[model samples]
Target: MIIDWQHHMSPRKVYEGRGGQGGVVIRDGKVTIHLKKEVYQVEKHLEFMAGAGIDACVISSSPISVDQCRMCNEYYHELGSQYPDKFFYLTPCLPLNEGAFDILDQGINEYGYKGVIISPQNAGEMLDSRRLWPFYEKMSAYNLPIFIHVSGHVLGYDAYDADYNLNIAFTREADIALNTLRLILGGVLTAFPDLTFVISHLGGGISSTLERIERYIDVRGEKFWTDCGGTPPFGAPYRENFRRLFDTLYFDMAGFEGGMNAVKCALTTIEPNRILFGTDYPYNFHTDGKDVARYIQDIRGLDLARDEINGMLGGNAATILG
Candidate 1:
């Protein structure tokens, strides 16, 4: 019954690693960056997906291009063609490319992709870069939420600084928050108004900014968080911005445990209906849905109504994919 928002399938070349180790050897806790195809073979992908208990999985890619995006779009198309209803698509948004929106339109009309996913860090610049405005416009037109996912490290500063610092997760989390703020300050959210947006990795530290990034008005007089890329905190200039800002947004509980504390706090601050259930499958540290189900069980026992749990489990996502 869980509709996972973020999932990555292996490319045809994924099985080509040494002894078929799959590229990106997880060397010393560092990402070596391998060719996408060599890491995600088709057969292994379907085998991993068969019993995941998910109604549908929207596949995303790392830092691939318009061509790779096209390839993945077709790949997901084949999966959807074969499975009929189980497999879905989320075309990638090429970084800083003029053709990104064209591809988005192509994915929608040609491939029937449900939505588009852009790496918050690699998204045509940053999430806030004005260069991405065309991309946002199309999303608003389709009423689709752009799911922001990171392939590996998100921070531009220390992505390869260390062999994988313990703070890598936190770094990506901060990257999302900063990028969201950049979008806010840059007027991406306010201008589009209805272009839906979703952030994976538990929304990339977005729950922390509910007070600051107002959906409607730009708050120039708020006590903004410092971590949100030098912006002021939530206050007068950004009043109902948060209200509308949060209106069509949602987040997936991907790596729930690492940021469970933040996720719990986010639920309290934002509408419980906006939180969606997702388990980063195939790459999950825990076993499967049963293990990820614990988080939902806890939420059910919380003060939240049963209806809210239903929305988080599928309603919100179904709304997005539709």
Candidate 2:
């Protein structure tokens, strides 16, 4: 069974309420800045899935405010319930807000959400901030992966500038990579060993940056250890610890155009089983210009063993979601 691990879903009313078209509208080769809610509709979504030969998908919302997280999750839950075989959804919660834990619990236990989606940054707090520990602990206890996606455009840049679009695209991946590295280097992975994190956009260039990161850690390990009170002796090599932490995390091939070099880099840096197929769906049409069928074909065309290909296509996600 083929699964698109990073599909997005937003309520139609949310778009209509804002006096906007509810679906993606491309003009002059540019996607308009609007929530494509029509693609999230049950019938339309299912039709796309069938056309793409996708058996199931894990859905989440387009980035919305903290206040709307619960409502959007509930809406997605209702949609998933109507076609349980083809859909599962992630719970959305503002980790820093009150009642966040309750919302997560309700989504998982009552609504049967497969997992949770948290933006790489909440307000000004990065994912590694202590404020999010309670939510992470709860997710760890539930044994579900945290789906990390980026929200908002590049900060401190002129939105109307010629390079705005390019900057936004670069920033999305950069932020995800930065937050991911923070989570690893900040000792969150070590502290919550049972917690699994599924980073979107093939870990946002992490595979290519692994070497540089290791070198940086090596150069700064002593100061970092001293600053943290050095209670745990820095006996083992830092690289070993980094590898252990990195191995525990998973990455999805979303927002990529089946670039063999990038895929090879990820395979070299991470285990095949830790890689999952993700299309980023409606948005992928804007970024990658390839449909779901072509995405499947691209992965199949890779120089991988049958079992490895199976794992990337769906097996890995099934195991992670379960």
Candidate 3:
């Protein structure tokens, strides 16, 4: 019953006529890949899953344009339908698009998508912006989790304008962490208490920085709101409110090397039930399926009980997705 919650599948058309090098280019310490052929090769993917001992995966696309998002969702829906038990998928939609809610409704009701995937920031609007409230409200009503992932291109900065590895390794996490903090401190969780947000990359370092963030709130609560630019009405008892809101969020263990130290950090800072297993597969393919096993082993080697381990491995995701 092991589930990998953060796998990606790209649409086939992206690599149709690409040159050798298989649509992958490494320039200036950044890896730019158009995995057109590999993403749609379902048989190979299933074989990889079998070798890796993964029972199921939630498939999403590499970030793309708004029209491409619809196309990717259609392809993923077809794939999931063909292998319902082995695959689930998240619907891709840009929150700012006029038809975003329509896409979500059709994807969930008609296509059987399990959730939705969004970037940390889209078109200069952060996830907590008022413009996204309708999408959040729709997802909350359906009780489907929102998957937050980041792409170097979609970020506020120009992707090719800087070194890729440096951005991914360092700057990306900061952006994700900042966006997550905005969601918490901006009162998104308070406003939509039932919404389930599963942020990837271990909350982009949120677990590690929780104490510092809380302390900042303690010392400069007023300035925090002022910096956020709007005095949105979050409930009273600000400190406790912050903690409660944070506790309601969930994180997926994706994008990190399989190591016990990160797991230990997460366990210490976040609730066991709020953590989910995710391999960030295909992206980690250089490990040849070993990373998945290592991640499982790392969690198993922790001081956690069997039930806690089970929850991290699959149970938590099952509960969230259901």
Report the number of the highest-lDDT candidate.
3
lDDT at 121, model 1: 66
Q: Quote the positional error of residue 154 for candidate 3 in Å.
A: 4.7
List ranges where model 1 is wrong by over 4 Å. 14-20, 23-52, 98-102, 151-155, 158-160, 163-167, 208-237, 257-262, 286-289
- Candidate 1 has a TM-score of 0.78
- What tens digits encode model 2's per-residue C-alpha lDDT throughout 1-322? 8888988776766556445664543323333344565544667666677777788888876444554676776787777667768887898877777766787788889888988998787766887788888888888889988998765543332443452354435656777888888887766887788888999888887888888878876777766567767432323578777887888888998877556677878888889889988877666553223376776887888788989899999999999878
lDDT of 1 by residue, 1-322 (tens): 5577666764463234223553454534555343344235545445444444456666776545566666666666777777776666787767476666677777788887778888776643787676777667767788766887754544455543564553444666677667665665556676777777777776665766655445324444443544446553233445555555555567777765534676677785567677776666556634334555565566556666777877877777777777
* Model 3: residue 59 alpha-carbon error in angstroms: 1.1
Regions more than 4 Å wrong, model 3: 15-37, 154-164, 226-229
Residue lDDT tens for model 3, 1-322: 7888998776666435234335454534465443435566787678768777789988886444666677777787777658878988898878787676677777889988888999888777887798888888888888888999865543554542564355666666777888888898776887888888988888887778889878877776666677767673464566667888888888988888665677778777899899998877676653357656766777887788899889999899988778
Pick the winner on TM-score between candidates 1 and 2: 2
Clash number for each model? 22, 0, 0
* lDDT of candidates 1 onward, in order: 0.62, 0.74, 0.76
Sorted on lDDT, best first, the list reads 3, 2, 1
Clashing pairs in 2: none
Instruction: Please give the TM-score that candidate 2 achieves against the real structure.
Output: 0.87
